[model samples]
Target: MKAKPCENILGLAMGSEQSRLRQQLVAASMGMVTTHVLGVCVQLKICDLLRDEPLAISELARVTGTQPEPLRELLIILASLDVVTIEEEAVALKPSGRLLLADQTGNVVQWVQYAAEFCAPAWMELADVLLGIPPAAGSKRRIYDALSSKRYPAEIFHGAMQDTQVEISATLAEAIRLNPGEVVADLGAGQSSFLIELLMRYPNTSAIAFDRFSDFTAMKQLAHAQGVAGRLQTIRGSFLDPLPFRVDVIVFKNVLADWSMEHLKRILTMARQGLNPDGRMYIATTFVHDPPSPDEAVVSLNLRVLTEGGDRSEVDYVAIAKEAGFELTRQERVAAIMILEFSLKGTA
Candidate 1:
């Protein structure tokens, strides 16, 4: 067989592209070491300590109760990652490093910490799980399943989720309008970030927060902190079961992505029956194909490891909603999160 000249050129180009992709994969694999480095720094409060000002390695090690030489090596790795800057013998936080401060409302430190400690183990065995390998490590469960079974504290898992949700609470609060006396319910309200924001923004409004009892302690604390405690009602149960009461608006903020499609449909169906005559449901989640795609891809993979579920498209949600006798009324994208509005088939 004789190959055409253009075919040979095309084959060479394809081969070159595949080689480049392989090199990129190798580079990405190296990022795991950096991830663990950042995880160690966060676990040791290194970033929090450096947030105020530059600190000498010796002082930082002393304060964090870490050995100096090992701490210095970690700091050097952080400097290489641009998380911190090394000047003379002191290390100071870079702008990006400020986000790791423990007190920062929306921080990635806990998220990274949770991933390194909990998710990474399961992620390492993902191929085993996918291949249905026998229980070498005992019955393998996804990260959320582990949390659900009380294998890991819910506080750590939910805290990590709240770390990210804090950034979008304000934006989500603005995406919906509430009349002075309208009622709202947040299904699976992990920390009540959304409910608290709504109550704060619309002083005349009241909210129902439903989740496990363990998750409500933080919600109560958050509501008290936000000075909206009196306006908030806490319900303890799984949203998978029927909601006890109805509301004028029901919210599934940042929750649907963690649910399987069957579960999503069941929840939406319950939301349908749980709504008042003129009620609406707002579903806020990171949709499948939003902008700044690299982060989205990473988040999707993480969610998949945790729940065996990840981001889904508008079409997917709409179809699920329609099956549940609801219709998609509107969708608004704020930051990387998408807020989808649904109404009963006959309602506006």
Candidate 2:
């Protein structure tokens, strides 16, 4: 039987819509499983083991203390995800999987670990949080407080931050120019990777790394390893308080976005106080766009909201800086990061 044209068109549209919905459902299901599978692989150091060479499934199980059959099943799933390649019975890391190797500089293993352990649990409480109900297990403290109080693993958290910041810092180091003797300060510097990069690039310039809960020992070790220890100084203090030293350049990298407007204003005022009259301040962060785009920055904004902070737009940032007695001189976008250069009202 020949169907009428409108009926055939409607039927085709319905079929297409059904297929789309089915794909969405399948993807959602796979996403959940993939996160857990990757987490288990990281915990077992599977990527690290496969770094040097591929190993037979049985041998991998023997070394990682797992049942060979179950390990093989996991590897099959990893292969489906394009994270690993399975040849006969041997498993090898693909490029994506190699990014999880522990020794790789700026590797995302720590971030993945933290997300699996901490963020996943917190996200389960999203419904309750949206309803104004506190999480069942802990006080209503912010994520930063939990980190500062040692309730969460601070080292892993900071390592995750360092991992994410590595590329951004490198890009920033290349973008901003420094005079031979200019001094820079990195506020809320986690491991001071940015300052270390800057010092490496500008050999004659020195830097100060300031953060209240900074791992000075680890920072020193990293700086020494990079041969920048002699040029970097670590300070332990809150940015809300008066800064102890004045500098030619002050930077807040992925720092200011973690505070409220009131706190941002206060912190910027403190930065103004700590800047030399002719000094410049650079803020490197991810800004929310005026008309939101469906991207990772939006996902980051949601995470910040969960942590009791929120990302701001350039308009909001400029207004906040003005209120704190600074003027935005220039702005630049590098990948997902935004760099806002500011100076005192009349200094620029």
Candidate 3:
């Protein structure tokens, strides 16, 4: 996904009415003012408090331990966000919001919780990044850092990534087809969702989930959750360092985008050396860009340069893989995602 060229608006200095409107938009977007908003489940909880269905503001505030006035204001914004419906000023969670509140398939509560605490704070520094500040420097003052050390940040990051990967795991697992004893490793595999899904599909196969020392606890948690603890070996180290073994398959998911082309090449080079005689690799990226991040530019891509070491991109990743001595095997598209597979030059 190549980036579209941004059209610069010239002459906003002139008193053109269009310039004034654009200025207003820019101000609102930059947090000169904010529209208070709540997540889906948070709004649903308010709905539940209101009545058996939709409740009036007073009833909602009484039930949810929030002031009625604030609850009403929140509802107005939520209604506009489409999380709820207002009937004669009585607000209730919409169907989508109900799904968000569902515990099993939704998992939105975790997402919202993570956003409120984990991801939101660092985003506040995006402007700093744009002004040529690096994420490591931003991390120093990050609220997440204040809440926990490097270890906790890594844990929260892995958890958040896992939450994100949950949306694609089933489809990705379906796209993958590997044989028994065909070594597969999830390099930089944080919480092991990909490896776990692979193991479930190929119960007889063995695999490894590898990442930095920070990911050790997450790997353990994922291993326990997937019930693949015994078959799954956990490798705790940096991907830039030597890997323990070469495998038939290496998955680098949503990883390459955060990486500069050089860091990515190093990773591919290491994995190349680690690959078994017939090893293959896969890489994934999200072309989507999200605006309104707390303080960050390029929300999806900044994850790498900030925490790990890479920036985001919509460049042709196939070229990147090819340069690393890998050739195309398959391309899988699911929803807004694209998963590209590559095999070493000589491998099928």
Candidate 4:
């Protein structure tokens, strides 16, 4: 019996769908492998070495301290990925590969390294995390705790945060309107990149970087390098404790999402006490959309949840701020982050 035309068409459509599904699965699996491969490239400074010119496979292996055969295999993989070009037994960095260099303007080497080394392992335990089991590092320890305790590489983590914040900080500096000579305090400011950007833009303003375990020496060096050292100060203490002094503006960039709602409220309440009578607070964080679009924000929320802290929607943020004795005054979305401005309830 021969199939009818309609039945044959349906069979073809089904076959196409199955093929598409298979392709999707393979792509996802390969994505996981590619992440670690990129991490290894960054760790070995392969792109940096290839920046000026191509290198013979043996020479590359000698410099990188890897066996030539394995190095060639890796280079072949990178060539296939379009991150490098290989010909005549030599490998050269591609334009895309240049973006992995440490000194590049928009480099993502640290972010890729941090994601592969720290976040990827946590993601592997996502199924168990959904089932209420914490990440394997320890159930009781949060990511920040691990950073403070030296379990994770603090410099790389902070550098990754700086990489992620560069554009957002520029956007925020333009979005914010700071008065001349106003004092700004950034709680949990890792390397004070945002504050440095703000200080550079608003020359008359001064800023404070407050955190319990930041590399203050590096922060000062960065500030000095940026020529903002005269206007920026460092305060070493936990934000959970009372702020050492009052300021006109309090900024929370990528901080609150790491904590639970109760802690968020408590932190806001403490922050409120440290604000001047007419002070304003700004929180820059990734907010979960109401309908939850499958984008970077959602991906960030998933990673946050896997580590036992997750993002919330704008409605939830408003409610939480109200509970903390503050009211939302304005909100703006910059890339995947939201900069929410708030003031004490009933303030003029």
Give the number of the best model, judged by lDDT: 2
Name the weakest run of 10 consecutive residues (lDDT summed) in model 1.
Answer: 2-11
- The estimated TM-scores of all candidates read 0.79, 0.81, 0.65, 0.86
Using TM-score as the yardstick, the better of models 3 and 4 is 4
What lDDT does model 3 reach? Answer: 0.63
lDDT of each: 0.77, 0.79, 0.63, 0.78
> 233-325 in candidate 2: lDDT tens per residue?
989899999999999999988777777789899999999999999999988877567566778554655455346556777777889999998
For model 4, how does the per-residue alpha-carbon lDDT over 30-133 read when each residue is reduced to its tens digit?
56666777889999999999999999999999999999887887777677667898899988999999989999977888788887877776676666755875
315 Cα displacement, candidate 2 (Å): 1.2
Residues 7-72, candidate 3: write the lDDT tens digits: 222335637888777865665464411122444335446534532477777766676778777667
Query: In model 2, which runs have C-alpha deviations exceeding 4 angstroms?
Result: 1-20, 52-59, 67-70, 87-90, 128-141, 216-222, 334-336
lDDT of 4: 0.78
Q: For residues 1-348, could you state the per-residue lDDT of candidate 1 as single tens digits?
A: 432112232233435777656655655665566668878888788888887789998899889888989888778778767788888889999988877786775668768878777777667766754685533433334655566678777777777777667756767788989998999998877774788888888999999988863457878887898899999998878787888998999987777887789898898888888899888988877656655388888777666666656778777888999999888899888766788898889887
By TM-score, who's the top model here?
4
Ordered by TM-score, highest first, the candidates read 4, 2, 1, 3
Steric overlap count per candidate: 0, 0, 15, 0
Ranking by lDDT, best first? Answer: 2, 4, 1, 3
* Candidate 4 TM-score, true structure as reference: 0.86
Better candidate by TM-score, 1 or 3: 1
